[model samples]
Target: MTALGTYVKVWLALIALTGLTVTAAGLHLGSLSVLAAILIASVKSSLVLSFFMNLRSEERVFKVMLGVAMATMAVIMLLTFVDVWYR
Candidate 1:
């Protein structure tokens, strides 16, 4: 498919994900709500990074760096959650 077509598809997917996030926020799922929101947000951010940021065409090193950064942030978030849960 053409670049324009691909962008339009991604834009539509982003909009749909945004709607899902809003719907998820309105639900009363307790602690699971936070996890659900985070998962949705992660997917949205990945789409933005891959398409809007043009990371798909970038070099392997850039992709590796981004993956490492994401992994680090995930670890930090997990640690914070664990600390909170044990307190």
Candidate 2:
């Protein structure tokens, strides 16, 4: 298959995953619903990043950049959570 064909497939799958996330929000799952949503979103994001962004075959530098970016965001999230934790 062509690159475009793979892209279309991934895009359609992402759409379905999005619908699932929205559907999940409507259902009651006690305290685990939010966690489930985050997990699915992460998976969907990975699919886009790997296929749409073409990161799966990229060079090591690109992977390093992604790691750095993700780490920075994680640090910021942790800092934010610190305040929430204290509250």
Candidate 3:
């Protein structure tokens, strides 16, 4: 529990960031709103994954694994969209 205090601080910071993201979404950025939200959400997710999951100090291979998973998902989603739009 030695690092408990640091963990709490990080969580609080993440929460604040999340709040900012939500508030920004409400400001009507038009087409950029969802992009901004996704960007912020990705950052917040990185924080949660690295700290809350204790993956920050993990091996390089683990980082590669996460990247690969993200890439695969992105490719799949984009392909589906392309298929729908090009049909």
Candidate that scores best on TM-score: 3
Q: What total of clashing residue pairs does each candidate reach?
A: 0, 0, 0
1-87: candidate 2 lDDT, tens digit per residue = 246789889989999999999999889886889998999999999998888888989899999999999999999999999999998
- Report clash pairs, candidate 3: none
Question: Any residue pairs clashing in model 2, and if so which?
Answer: none
Q: For model 2, how big is the CA root-mean-square deviation?
A: 1.9
Maximum-lDDT candidate: 2
Q: What local lDDT score does residue 32 receive in model 2, on the 0 to 100 scale?
A: 88
Using alpha carbons, what is the TM-score of model 2? 0.84
List, residue by residue over 1-87, the lDDT tens digit for candidate 3: 339987898889898988999899899999999999999888888888898887788898898999999999999999999999999
Question: Candidate 2 at residue 27, lDDT?
Answer: 92
lDDT of each: 0.90, 0.92, 0.89
